[model samples]
Target: SLRINKGMHVDGNWPALGAAAAVAHSLGLTPAQTAQAVQIAACQLPMSLYLPVRSGDTSRNTYLGHSAQLGQSAALAVASGITSPGNAVREYAHVVLSKEPEPFDDTHGFHLLQAYVKPYAAVRHVHYGAWAACMLRPALDPDKIEHVILDVYEEAVIYCGNRAPQTPLQAQFSLSFGLAAMLGWGRLDPWVYREPQFQDAMLRALEAKVQVQVDASWTQQQMRGARLRIECSDGSRYEQEITAVPGDAQMPFTERELVDKFLGYCEASMPLDSARLWARQLLVAPTNTHPFPFWNLPQEKTPC
Candidate 1:
């Protein structure tokens, strides 16, 4: 799937569809009406193309407001306990599609590259890119090293550079920030995107030291990876190239690894036992045959 921007799910569009589905269940719309409500949400979605990394920008509003919220409103307007379905879809359609359309630009290709990495490409690349720099960090002495040279695919150069990232979202999207985070701190984890770590002055300085260059050969090959080469004042060099981003469909995490990953994410919020139970429930939810309102709904509402 060509999941542009933050993806239909990550940007809250899929949830909007789910919210609409919930309302559809309560109201018992005909299969045709239910289908229409879903189509309205899907068509009304303002595709996120060239979004600024800065979260404070008004452009970010489309991500939060357009698809998910509209879907929710459409479903509620037609539900039994809500307003009449009369003209509701039409009213919502006019409101939804009325916005000025987003433009097609160079950033659209970056979104495709991001989706190629899948699940968590932004996080994974930043994590490993930083790791590659960290591996070279120990070999260098400040007095002996010159600036670091980062060779990445064209998409990486476009997607990750030439920005001042003030928020986690910005940092998450930044390749320079990732390299700096790894070189300066030897790590780029979730916490690196948060508080004091993100704002570390030295890290910011290192970010400026990173020079990203596009490798046309890699771009031609349609590879999603990066190579970091460090040149010392003494003329020595260290280099590593990452050709396959982790979680890529071609080389996916094992089922057990995925479970462990789920447990890891859940452990942050819930007790280990509870996390395991939650993971199990989510894993098995699809196979469940009972007429539970949420799960029993047809899968037709799901975005492609």
Candidate 2:
């Protein structure tokens, strides 16, 4: 099967379609125009390969940024009177699957309700093992750790099986590496994916101890979860199971966490007060009826 892991890299492919749809909506395009925009995006969708991700190539990181830019351009092109063949999507769909296009069963309901916001820089599949390891961090000493076992759903293991990854992208996609990194650093934020962390002797030792297994129960339930067990040389064992990571609706981030996350990103470019003000304004922008704010960053050479 040409699935996400086998032949396709989903992150490289899906963003264009999403960006097209979102831009079309924001521009208030009619259904037909929106369809045209999507068709244009579909026709130009970049082909994806999983091999680069497996080898930790830097090109893999550029896929999403390029996809998003392509998407935005596709939507704007449509708004500027560009036209795309109406059947581009179904044609490629049939070609890709080598089967007739089947209707989507909308009975599964709206996709927005199923969305998960990410708290860490790693892939979603890596989160379960990482989260479980973090839960056990307080109890175990990194130096004395003898072996670690990560039992997770089959798909997670299949898609993200890298061990002792040496690069940022590889670490992001590696369940075993994520577990060790989280245990060593006590967190799985972007900073943990740096070169210093990659070269850390303790983290490397922890990665060597990890053994991943497939848990049939989680696979059958289609659940994103992991059971992590660590054995230390001191004749001690620690184990924990994480059924979900934060950002899942059932385990969502608190309001404070959300605000902090937003500010964290914003503060990199603007001052704290400006970021806070931008956060407030952006959070309430959807409810506000004023003309769409393009960009309201203060240009004044003084603090607000």
TM-score to native of every candidate shown = 0.58, 0.80
lDDT of each: 0.61, 0.80
Which lDDT tens digits does candidate 2 get at residues 219-274? 89878789998888999989999898889989988777878877776655679987
Cα-based RMSD of the predictions, in order?
8.5, 5.2
Candidate 2 Cα misplacement greater than 4 A, ranges: 1-5, 72-90, 99-110, 263-281, 284-294, 297-304
Residue 231 in candidate 1 has what lDDT?
77
Instruction: Give one clash count per candidate, in the order shown.
Output: 0, 0
User: In candidate 2, residue 160 scores what lDDT?
Assistant: 89
Say which candidate scores most in TM-score: 2
lDDT of 1 by residue, 1-304 (tens): 1223322223534446555665566567775556556555554454454355544244554665665577766665554334433343344335544433343254535444444323332445454466567668887664455678788777665555545578776777778888777677665556577678778888787777778888899889977677888877788988887776546655666667667766655655679987776666666755654433476556876422
* Model 1 worst lDDT window (10 residues): 1-10
Reference-based lDDT, residue 170, model 2? 82
